[model samples]
Target: MSVTLVLIDACAASPKESRVQGAVQAVPKTAVHRVVVQVNSDDPVIMKHAITNSLNLLKAYGDRNEAAAVEIVAYGAGVNMFREDTSPVKDLLRFLHATHPDVVFSACGNTIAIMERNEGHPLSLVDGARSVPFGVVRLVELQEAGWSYLRP
Candidate 1:
């Protein structure tokens, strides 16, 4: 099985293939594009914008056969963006989960616990959304690790 998909440039020989004449450099998956996005608003408009940006990043990198990871960290009131019940953009979230393999939706574990306690029941996140211990800390860690930060 292939480790990852490679896109061959029809116009030029890839460097990975050979060192012959007119060889062009190949963009290996190892050169990953990373971005951490913050979404702390409960507004649907903001949530949609963040999701759109993530999709765009993934598409741009995918077109070049490069690896990309777009992480959306939802904390505070923004945690509602990932809630299965309260999210206004749950449809879009579900679509992304089904179609976009490179995009991640991260809910704050601390926020989740608080919300659950307030509601007196467990809260379910949108399909494919995962929980992190602390959203802000994760954001800081990602930025420290050289991931581009964006707030939308």
Candidate 2:
């Protein structure tokens, strides 16, 4: 149950910064399941389902006293789920982030740039959502790191 906080920069030259926060009992990697959930649709129901599935998986692992990590990555129209103003599930996202430190929300910088360009203003993201250079690249990296991928 070790809690690690990581700060990932979009730039490759900047090595991601990570820190072990409060120590919870640590679990071995083999015992922990890692998942990266992809969200690319603007449909609110799809967004809700993706989040619900991730939360359920985390809860199941916790119930068994096992460890699991869930990352929800958004790009294209799906990036709207992380936007403060347009997100239909902003409160739910914030609540999940507050309760589950093992869960991560990532917003694609490329998508955000396109959105901002269309809107002609900077968009605000929900709290706890991190920016990644590209969502597809992030997915590939996560899969290469042995995380199972899910798109709901």
Candidate 3:
């Protein structure tokens, strides 16, 4: 399997700075706090940390998830996070999805595709887990759009 990678340069301009460079590059701040969390490990403990971190952020905003947009992007071995048959935290996933529309759970489509091909069958994501083209690219896009990045 090809390793997923995200190269974030410290010297690179932020979204705010990019806006000053050109209006077309500007991404408007839609929420007070925008966060994107990355999950690339298959470890259940790591996945739980990501969920807890997201809950903490939302709780800080009085459990008003809309006050802080949060997204969880999973890829690599972490794709198992959304695997319907193998997920260890499906209960929490269901609760969070039912209660928080602002917390988006994204599975990497590329990883899913590779897994399906290798297994010679299709896969099913747990309820409320959606697909993105690529986890690394999703994280990069969110950062570019001024979303705070977190990995747990």
Candidate 4:
């Protein structure tokens, strides 16, 4: 089964715009699929669009009954999505995680450290997330592991 990974690095917006630059990396799925979104900013608009696009992709898989995995990695200013106390979109984030069992979220440890410097404590992650050492490095590893990359 062929697997594809969506490597999201651009701040999310319309699926087309957010997905254009990274289109080359994605492989069509014959058996499995994965989508990884790397967030690098705190802009609500970007995050919202990213969330929507990821959902759209998931729906595509669900409709086809294709086996797939989805992940969201927040790095740099993107770590704000998982901030324990101050995230502006906590409710929606929670909803997405609970509803989507296959979706995993990762927060960059390095970004968390920086966030701590400003907020005074390491940020807690959302319910269904894992924290990683670095976002960019993880993306590279995912690609190397044969998961096609998408920059949406």
Pick by lDDT: which candidate is best?
2
Measured by C-alpha RMSD in angstroms, how accurate is candidate 2? Answer: 9.7
lDDT of 1 at 11: 21
lDDT of 2 by residue, 52-81 (tens): 787778767776766677789999999999
lDDT of 4 by residue, 1-152 (tens): 22233432222111111121233222233437766776778887677766776777776766667656666777888888777676666766776776664465777877787778987866677677667778888777666766656554
User: Which ranges of candidate 3 are over 4 A from the true structure?
Assistant: 1-30, 63-66
TM for every model, in the order presented, reads: 0.77, 0.80, 0.78, 0.73
Report lDDT (Cα) of residue 98, candidate 4: 60
Clashing pairs in 2: 1-25
Candidate 2: 10-residue stretch with minimal lDDT? 6-15
Off by over 4 Å in 1: 1-31
Worst 10 residues of 4 by lDDT: 11-20
Give the alpha-carbon lDDT of every model.
0.73, 0.75, 0.74, 0.64
Ranking by TM-score: 2, 3, 1, 4
Off by over 4 Å in 4: 1-31
State the displacement of the C-alpha of residue 27, model 4, in Å, after optimal TM-score superposition. 18
Report RMSD for candidate 4.
Answer: 11.2
* C-alpha lDDT of residue 63 in model 4: 69
